[model samples]
Target chain A: MERLPAFELKRPTSLAQAIEWLAATPEARAIAGGTDLVPNLRDGIGAPPVLVDLSRVPGFDAYEIRTAGARIGAGVTLARLASDAGVAAALPAVSAAAASIAGPGHRSVATVGGNLCVDTRCVYYNQSEWWRKSNGYCLKHLGDTCHVAPTGTRCHAAYQGDLAPALIACGASVELAGPRGTRTIALEDLYRDDGLAHLALEPGELVVAVAVPAQPRGAMSAYRKARARGAIDFPLAGVAVRLAVDDGRIAAIDVALTGTNSRPFRLAGTAAWVGRAVDDGLLAELGKAVQKQVSPMRTTVTQSNWRRQVASVEAQRLVRDLAKVAS
Target chain B: MAKRVLSFVVNGRLREEAVGDSTLLLDLLREQLGLTGTKRGCDGGECGACTVIVDGRPQLSCLTLAARCDGAHVETVEALAAGGRMSALQAAFHEKLGTQCGFCTPGMIMAAEALLRGNPAPDEATIREALGGNLCRCTGYVKIIEAVQAAAAAGGGR
Candidate 1:
């Protein structure tokens, strides 16, 4: 294991205390679950001088089901989210996606907020600093041109998170707290369309919680993932679909795709294509439309063309399976 | 660098230690507490060799911060035996030839323990899914699955 460089760690017991510390120390970073931060630090990805450990902060780990939806604290581990009976029954797609993340160990330590705010990843950019420097530092870090798409001026790092796509499909919202105070926003607005500036979160802002709407009755959801390996591998392409049916007709549909772009791409037009009743042909057309919507660059574990193809196939399969249940 | 004082129970013993901020539970268990039963295969959480029971649930020690485990109860594979009597699952693994090279043994045992604690008798698919995170380069998981089945059949009462 690579040794982590020297840094100070502070454990705050309250949100106000944590905010005060962050406000005082400009270089300090808040760490709820270190599943993402520690690995990056050891890899020389990013090293802040001080780490504000938020695990001990009171009330930060509580998850509640309200009249509107479920409020998941930032410190709630992925394992808890996946295994919780309430979360599973209420939001099965989110739970299914959580269950399919890296592995049990990672799921036990990785938090929902961390996964949602995870750094945009690419085969070229997720490497050690030395490795990227040796390769002349692609557009994600220092250099000008995007190695993944040499002709394009933008970076093509994909948001390979399993939960974010599912959460977005469920119409979730998030709460953010920082030195400037707290604010709530739609989860869709948190991510930018560009890979270079993937998230719109400002410096010193910490994601506090995510609120997911209650699962409507007769709503069926599923997440399909394709990866090189069955266990402990990131998705080459993944699809999350949530459909609400009433009297054998589709009431609402949300389709979100991941591992194909910097941010989770919502197939709005494609979702609209399968409005009321979906047949095999309609599902196929929707898949084709989703394939056209996703512009995956050659930065994933699989080839870019293969990722796009798999995305189309998986999206079609997920929607078809969901429609079958609805029928 | 600042050090944090952590107090916790490990293997039926209460202990206190001062550790660095970045010290992972894997490092603390092996380097500081001298419990090497938890192996470190992939420090990146891909490999579950460092699995340990934290607050009654199996967690990857490699990814968990030692500080995060303060005030919690940790059970390692070392505590599985009672008065040198091996656990039924451990004996079943030995009888079934479930382990080879022994790198993934501790983690596999802990995972099995957690599985049995929650589900005393699991089907083939359930056992496979529970042990999916743990990688075994040798013995091909056939015997491991069989051993778990045998233990469950034997009532897994212990």
Candidate 2:
């Protein structure tokens, strides 16, 4: 059994207090759910001198559904997101993505913020400390060179989180609080392409909540992923599709993908599909576009080409399904 | 940074003990309280061997901090037996041959207990989803599913 390294755990009663604590201690890491952070800590991935647990922060667990959209607190558990009636009604893709993550016990404790901020993974990077030492640590952590792309300078670890793609597909934005006070940013912009430094958050900054904008009338969305098992495994390649049909034609469509690269991104050329009818020819072209845009590295144990194919296949299937319902 | 005295109720008994800040709930339950029913398998969230009911929710004890459980109600496999008699869920697991190696039974039962409490008559798909976190290396999960179904059939879900 791997043991977590010792650190001071501070429980803050308010979001302001949590921000202050983080600002005061630069080495402090904010912990929500601790599902990913705990295991990473045990595996010697990080050694933060202090931990600010976010569970005690008031209003952090609040879930509100508005006419515009929904404001989901950072502390809201994945279970709640999956089971919440309003969330299911308004943002079905978000709920489906949350429900697909890990398993029931994990979903009970895993938070939206935690899943959004989950670390990028690579076969060489995520391992026991002893195993890493024996194999020579990767560039994402202590090592100088990346095992995935030995010649390349950039870390190739893949971001396998399921929520980012779904949320990004829905055009969500996140409210972040830091020493500079609070500001909102597009969820897509919150991530960078670098696996070693995936998040664009400033030092001591914390994600407060995610705000999902209102969906268009007649809109339908869904999220799906390929994994080794039915549960308890990260997505090999996850896809989220949101589309609306008006008068028997595709009015709008958004496609986002994860587990294929360092950052989850809304496919750029999806707008080209607008006004087109859902058919076998359109689906084939969509699949080709997806496969062309997504570049899967050798971060996972599975074949990178297989993941790329899976991502395209999933996107086409989801788009087809949602378009059928919308029309 | 320093150890603090934490108070929490386990199996209907209140306990106050000094624990390290880094101490895991699995360690606190198995080591300090001597409640070995919560087995430590992977010691990581990947395996649900240390699953426990906390405030009516099934959580992985290995990933939970002991300090976080303060003032909370926790239920382990030990609480299911009354007067040396196995609870209906436990009895179902026993009678249905759910345990081959018996290592994952405690977690399986605890997870099922939480599920049944929430949805008394969960269908086969629901049971599989609820127990998805728990891994049983011994059996092919046929008997485990049967055990949970049998318990629900016998009105044990209440």
- Please provide TM-scores computed only on chain A for all of the candidate models, following their numbering: 0.93, 0.98
Q: What TM-score does chain B get in every candidate?
A: 0.96, 0.97
The most accurate candidate by DockQ is 2
lDDT of candidate 1 over B50-121, digit per residue (tens): 999898887888877787788999999999888888888888888899888989989988988888988999
What are the per-residue Cα lDDT tens digits for candidate 1 across A1-327?
576767787788888788888777887877876767777777776678888888877867789876568999988888889889877777888889998887665676678888888877888887777888898988877778788889988888888888888988888889998878999998888888788888888777788899888777677788888987797677888899888877666777888888888888678774465346777777778778877988788886578888888889888888778877777
Model 2, B1-158: lDDT tens per residue?
56889999999999999999999999999999999999999887877989999999999999999998899999999999999888889999999999999999999999999999988899999999999999999999999999999999988643
- Look at candidate 2 and tell me the lDDT of residue A129: 95
Candidate 1 ranges with C-alpha deviation above 4 Å: A142-145, A215-217, A274-276, B155-158
What range of 10 consecutive residues in model 2 chain A has the weakest lDDT sum? A318-327
Which ranges in model 2 have alpha carbons more than 4 Å from their true place? none
